[model samples]
Target: MSETATVFNQQLAARSAGGSTDAPPPVRHVCVVGGGTAGWMTALMLATTAYGPRLKVTVLESPQVGIIGVGEGSTPWLRGFFDGLGIEESEWMPACNATYKSGITFEGWSTKPGFQRYFHPFASMLDNMTMHQFVDNVHARLEGADVHAHPDRFFVAAALARQGRGPRARPNFPFDIWYGYHFDATLLGQFLAAKALERGVQHLQRHVTQVQLNEQGDIAHLQLDGGEPLAADFFVDCTGFASLLIGKALQTPFVSYAENLFNDAAIAMPTPLGGPIESQTVSTALRHGWAWKIPLSNRHGNGYVYSSAHCSADEAETELRRHLGLLDADVPARHLKMRVGRMENQWSRNCVAVGLSQGFIEPLEATALLFVQRTAAALVEALEQGDLGPAAQQRFNDSMRTRFENTRDYIVAHYKTNSRTDTDYWRANAENMRLSESLQGVLMTWLSRKPLAAGLKAGRFGGGYPIVSWYALLAGMGIFPDPRELQPPTSHQARHRLDAVDDFVARSATNFPDHRELLAAIPPRVGDKTLQLYLW
Candidate 1:
């Protein structure tokens, strides 16, 4: 056996000496490599402890290594994550130039002649009987209704976004909200880093040039670009695609999901909008790829993700510019070359790979940032139980893999079920495409509008969003699971609910604040400059 492997096993044995029945030793030092959102998030969460002094966290990030700054959309789970960290939105909003993102607008996917779009709104009305009744009314329209009509009219965010409004915490609401945000990813990394450092986590400014394995096959230490080595009992790999520790040193094989997901490259550009900023993200499909328009308080984050095998980067850039005609000159265009896959093991030996180090599933639904937050949360939870012993490490690995697969399945579902044949990219979906077992089953049951089977195990991380979110996207894409089985509301109920919704939507538009106006509410910071990072 390799000397490194031997060392790894020995360390595992020492850590697991207490046996499966006893609580494992506390993690004394955690070395996190990479300082992007993933790295800082891991450090911040891991440094905080119910055990208090049981954990000590350190982050190594290159002052020069730029991060891929493209993801601007997120799910509502972010609010909970921030709350868990005891972070006030106002503390970081100005520094990040953030804006509220209620949901995504999927445009140009239908069998009809002209492209049709639908809003996959954030909050569902299933909680309120009146809203549920309204949804029942809309369900009728969904049954045999005018398919070209905007089904999103029934959604709160879609309606409020149309009026360019943001969300405010309403005490009278049935549920708080279903909202996320659009911000500069690089800025967010810096914001998290500052917070992490303030909370007693050590930050090292250096690039990892080499990862050394000890005699037992575990990561023993990593050498910096031009400095001494840093070692720790546990390591969290957030080094983006380099996967220096997990993939290179630990030699964990990667499981590709390329066949199921088509788009491989993305071209991103940021454009500053001076007018009233919109508080919604719009994802429109093109002939060969898809384009995302994420609105921020100060600017719009736009990108085109395409299959590089089908089209060149130059062509994609031109296409993106054509779509965004009024783009500013200062908004330089950049390209992100990526793969859609996950590592065979996210947590292997004494190391765990998070963010792009583990793998990337493209930036379709903005799962990248949220994935980091969730992974950090899971790691924190596991560490709180004790150190990353074999059992805990295995559980962590399983959970990360499950989350990646779930995200991959959902992204693949979007492309595989697309009925549009406008271009070669769209036609790719028509081919006999492979699907994960979970996605395959979802596709099958979608034909009947049946809910997911009870006792569904989320495996690793909780599935992003829920099956219902998929149902909305599928229905909007014209991939009716069971059109005949769809229920419609009664006549009187339908009319009454529609009228109430119309009134509610109208009132919401009038009352809601504009995106830029909300940002202006923030107290101005002296010498606040926007941070930019380049990801090649």
Candidate 2:
């Protein structure tokens, strides 16, 4: 390189603002309170990516406090999170007792004959060929014409799960597959903590007795129960429902989803595996709420998410026990109270809220970890922009606020459209009229048999889930005229055969190995090696 060119590049890299050559003080330390998946994930991402070697991260975790692990499932986003860190599935999956998840299957939620069960699969390569056809049929069905709109028949993930096949394809496959996973949440958190520590993130075992604030109301420092006061340039709250820093100390307002969503309590228990594990979560409708059966490599994670207002905890637990065929078994159940809402200001002052501290919209779609990853990644971007003013803070809040509300709407739609009327719980959900304008617009468009694309393009219904996802939820719930009162479509496009779609999905499944076979193929390892290998 020439001397002149080298000097020019060096000069361009120099920082200056307002005719001053000096730059602002760098963010040197980030203190994360609470240590489960959220805290460790935030620390890991920041330590490894955000500020390079210039920033140090510390996680203050209470030894006694446990995380809400009812959501043992994850969306496809987890795959990306692991990949971005250059972690391999073979290594991590075997360590966490995790298994592939093609998608979730809704059972008994809708009692309609053919819709008694429907699979809502993750996005797939073959969906491009069939998603439009599914939407076209949904439009036709809503317009008083008989059409096939069940989501299971249109996508490859559904097919994969149904055939007991893994969601990933062989090395030679041209297209990539998107699927989630079911894992032991506790093990997964420990795995992340180990990974974070290996990369220079600090782990402190201390209980926060008090949170100090500056005159500007920003978090100043933390007082530990038996340790020195700790301070950092920035703070992250992963304290779950207690919301220590973001809620109590920062005093951020919260927006509740009580009216839109009613389920608030869950009774979780573990059940032994009976058959070959399938790549799907089965959500069966119960009298009070729903029961989730998540498949793990060794044991099945079972839980009943119900409304305490509709049924007592004892009753809810009994129902869940019965659902899992554990009524006579001596298995213990862990009950959890859900604080269903989002913080009004997730990023207030110098603190950013992650995981349950920020919000929770139930685990119907298994999106708990998705929010954790998204917030951590977004926080990195906002920090990189080098602005922490009110305007910049407000912009981040607005973006997250919309995301939370949109996710809430999707979960709410599941109950509002349920076909069960056997109990007051189901009836109340079906009669729920309190809804966001965004959700109302989407449902209204579907009811009117108009294209959903219009609402999306016009920004009427905000984008939380994809347009195809909305179609799957509605169409999967059997929201249409009675099959006995149906007639064939009048339009040729609507009447076009879907034999090709069926054949394509069927053929695609061939590229994937059976779920049981795939699980067996992972190189043998002593169970949960991270726990044995990674010592704080």
C-alpha lDDT values of all predictions: 0.69, 0.82
- Show model 1 residue runs off by greater than 4 Å: 1-25, 111-115, 124-131, 134-150, 170-175, 326-331, 448-464, 480-497, 508-511, 522-536
Q: Ten-residue segment with the worst summed lDDT in candidate 1?
A: 527-536
Query: Which parts of model 2 have CA positions greater than 4 angstroms off?
Result: 1-25, 491-494, 522-536
Candidate 1 per-residue lDDT over residues 1-536, each given as its tens digit: 21222322333354457422244436678899988888987787776644334567889887778887667777766765665555777888778978888777888766633326777766633223233443344344445543222346555677667777776433233333356788888888889899989978998888788889989898888898776899898899998998888998899999877786777889888776766677778888887888998877667888899998889998888889889883435558888888678889888888888899988888877888767776776776676566567888778788778778888877777787778776877787766457667777676655544434331334322155453465457656765423455445455434554566666666655545665666667432222121211100
Q: How close is candidate 1 to the true structure, as a TM-score?
A: 0.84
Q: Residue 297 in candidate 1 has what lDDT?
A: 64
lDDT of 1 at 217: 92
- How do the residues 62-147 of candidate 2 rate in per-residue lDDT, one tens digit apiece? 87787876679998778767756657788789898999998999999998888889888777656777777888888788777877
Task: List clash counts for every candidate, in order.
Answer: 14, 0
